[model samples]
Target: MKAEEMWKASTGKGVKVAVVDTGVNPDTPSLKGQVLTDEVPKEVSYKATEDYDGHGTSMAELIAGTGADGTLRGLAPDAKIVPYRVALTGLDKAEMQKAPHLAKVIRAIADSDVKIINMSFGGKIDLPDVREAMKYAHDKGKLMFAGTGNDAMETEFTGFPAAYPYVVGVAASDESGVVGEFSQHGNYVDLAAPGLDVPTWCDKTFRSYCTGEGTSMASAIASASAALVWSAHPDWTANQVLASLIDTAGRDWARDDPSTYLGYGLIRPRKVLENKDFNPGPADTDPLAKENFRGVVDESGKPVAASPSPSTEPSKGTETSDGDDQGDRASATASETDTSGNTTLWVALGAAAAALVIGGGAFAVIRSRRGA
Candidate 1:
């Protein structure tokens, strides 16, 4: 992804990303001054800074961690993080009850100044309230990203929020730009990012960083990729930012005919950040209008209302590369539901590396060479 060169162009300054997950620990060495805890809405701020599972903190760091003292460096290191703690799986029953409702949390972030929303969790069930909240956030012009899921080899269930209209469903990929075998595939998959073999927090203990793999990291990296573009082009609207990403994404198939596994292929923000003369088309036009409208259905299998007309002249000059073949697109409904459970964080922990304490045990750090 030419991250070092991309950083030379834009370090994601002046951008704030909202990480909706288990929770985030702001005291981590790399996140010392990168988190804006006070900016989180009080109504949904329960334990926002207290990471019960270390998953949310890892997502935050993936987006904006400073990489201080050899800690994991984020794709957009200069960006700020606004943390929101909601009850995802792995939390105890008591903490789950105390955590804010996912719908309420989404609504609150929709009303905030955050530019992007990164949801690194997924659930088999689809909640109506959360769907409405996603629509609200879309209407408010907030860019949102969620994991397509990591259960492709199993049930291959369509994850909620990711399947919801207006939310960009991201899939996990590797350094070769090949979609991870575990990444769930469907029409909802909008983009792919490096998710396999990434470094992340081991657990709530924050004792050491471990090799992690999942769509959760992909979503965070996708969010950071947007931050880099948004920071470089601060005036671009959410639609414009999204359009730029779609336009510049690496792909083998035609833009209109997306792949089930890789969607628009791997995210390449450096393509946008490095181009000063790039035109992001119309700010009010949605890049994913076709998928947001035609690809989704109602509870009774009726097609949803169509979005406004897309840009008559879509952005030209997309970067293409070798990728998997295209497949049939699927439709989702706002009223879809399952009796399963709440959203689950998508990270799968791997072996921990030797830990190194920085600054008198302020936090422990671990190193990895894998690209996010």
Candidate 2:
């Protein structure tokens, strides 16, 4: 998104986005003036803006980076970032040994005043505390967005935070508008965004930048997109904004039968923002009523979520690797087949390790220090 476009309309100027991930270093040139640490609750406020792993910082940059020193430019540069550090990936060995304490961090965010929450992390397990906090934030009118996880070709399971109802689940697609091979899919995916070879913070050290791929990047873009919409229509409640996004999301499938792979299709903020005459329908009506997932009630007051019967099976996808003449490798185990109909792609490796190998190959070998 361009600054000129934002200036002409709304560029997330007044919106405060809560980046709930590893941590964000305030010293980064692009985020020098955009991070807010004082507002975080005192209990979990330590390292609120100190990004130990670069992933959180990169997400922040994608959401509100000012593009200093030709760094990564955020989708909503004018927005403010409220860093809410969690212990998803960058904790020390000692911290990991103590049994990951993610619940406390989520609880703190639920009590904050930020209106938009961006979660770029998730795992297979659905932590009870985390789900409860999501409900709290939703009831508080805060728009929450999360990555659908990135283990697409391997584990077909969608990530947490995204699985929760009322949360906007984001997947990844390339510049030409094809979904990435690694973006986890299912009924959870609500929107897609750009998440390939994009610039990102190198690490918590705040020393340099690198290019990487993951659903996390896509989630950040989705968050930034929400910030743009919210910035333009500040008076609209969270429900209204989310409803508009779903209603306007780009999709060719039946409005009621969302695809398991693409979900609601790619997100085109340009379409929604360019048309000022667009009406988002009713605020209370959920556009995804007919899709999988059951308790979700639609305009007709019918259940929209999948039932808990034997017929309801988990979705799975198969990824094919190029250069190697081999049969498609179905993720260890999952439900449903992902045939994009016409789109074929190469497979991607796992996250963290791949981020280091593919992105920091030379840097890691020469610097003798791997990113946390």
Candidate 3:
């Protein structure tokens, strides 16, 4: 994406991204001064800095980590992170009960100064409560991104939150720009980003970085990309920010006919940043209104045939001891029960070496190779 050239214009300085996941570790070498714990709402905030499985910390770092102490730098280093802890699949039963409800958490973030909400996790079942919370956030004009899930190897069920209206579903891709086989595909996919073979925290210890990949990481990058565009034009509404991304995204197919694997193609924030005269269209008009208002389709881009709830199986986080095979792994956050009483699976993004980053001056650096 040659993001470095675009960084000459914006570094996502004034933007604040809400990392809605397990929890964000503020003490990480790269995130030392980036996390804003005090800004979090007291009611919804519980162990907001305690990362249970390293997934939340990695997503936080991917968006705003400062890259201090030689740790991985985020795509928007100048931006700030607001951490929120919610119940996921792998959390203890007692601890999960203590965590705030997903609806409350989303509403709190919607009322906050956060302009972007990055949910690198997803669930299979559609929960009305969660959907309502997301709608509230959307009404407040917030840009949200979520992983489409990493269950491409298995079934093609739509990942919740991402499948919801107005929430952009992001898919994972490699340096070569090919979508990962694990990235879930459906009409809900709004955009794609580098997700394969990226650097992430090895575990909750936050001691060292390891290679990992999944739609989770891709969602973080997409959120950071929006931060860059929004930072450059702070007055732009959420619709405008998203419209700019869809307008400037890289793709080989026609804009109207988006790819199921890569919706609107790989994100290229630089294209929007470089064009000072870019028109972002209407503020209230949603860029994804058609998909949201009309109806959703299956992985083949056909209209929804059936809604199946996949059983919650603990997937391993993608970790590779060698640079060879990238297999299934644990998701960043555990699966949680939806309103349907079904256990929802959150895609586990582990380590891989896909090129997802390019330099953007000193402030805009994602953990990927220098070229697209």
lDDT of 2 at 250: 65
Choose the strongest candidate by lDDT: 3
Candidate 3 TM-score to native: 0.82
Q: List the residue pairs that clash in candidate 2.
A: 23-51, 24-49, 24-51, 25-51, 293-305, 293-306, 294-305, 294-306, 315-335, 316-335
RMSD per candidate (Å) reads: 10.6, 10.8, 8.5
Off by over 4 Å in 1: 295-372
The deviation in Å at residue 143 for candidate 3 is 0.5
Say which candidate scores most in TM-score.
Answer: 3
TM-score of each: 0.81, 0.77, 0.82
Regarding TM-score, does 1 or 3 come out ahead?
Answer: 3
lDDT, candidate 3, at 68: 66
lDDT of 1 at 227: 96
| Per-residue lDDT of candidate 1, residues 120-236 (tens digit) | 877666677888899899999899998777656555466767878889988776665666666666767788777666667777788777665677778888898899999999999
Assess the local accuracy of residue 309 in candidate 2 as a C-alpha lDDT between 0 and 100.
18
TM-score of 2: 0.77
> What do the candidate models score in CA lDDT, each in turn?
0.71, 0.60, 0.72
- For candidate 2, lDDT tens digit of each residue in 56-172? 777787778776665555777799998876555436656444422555665666677687988777665655676667767776778887777665665555456676766777766
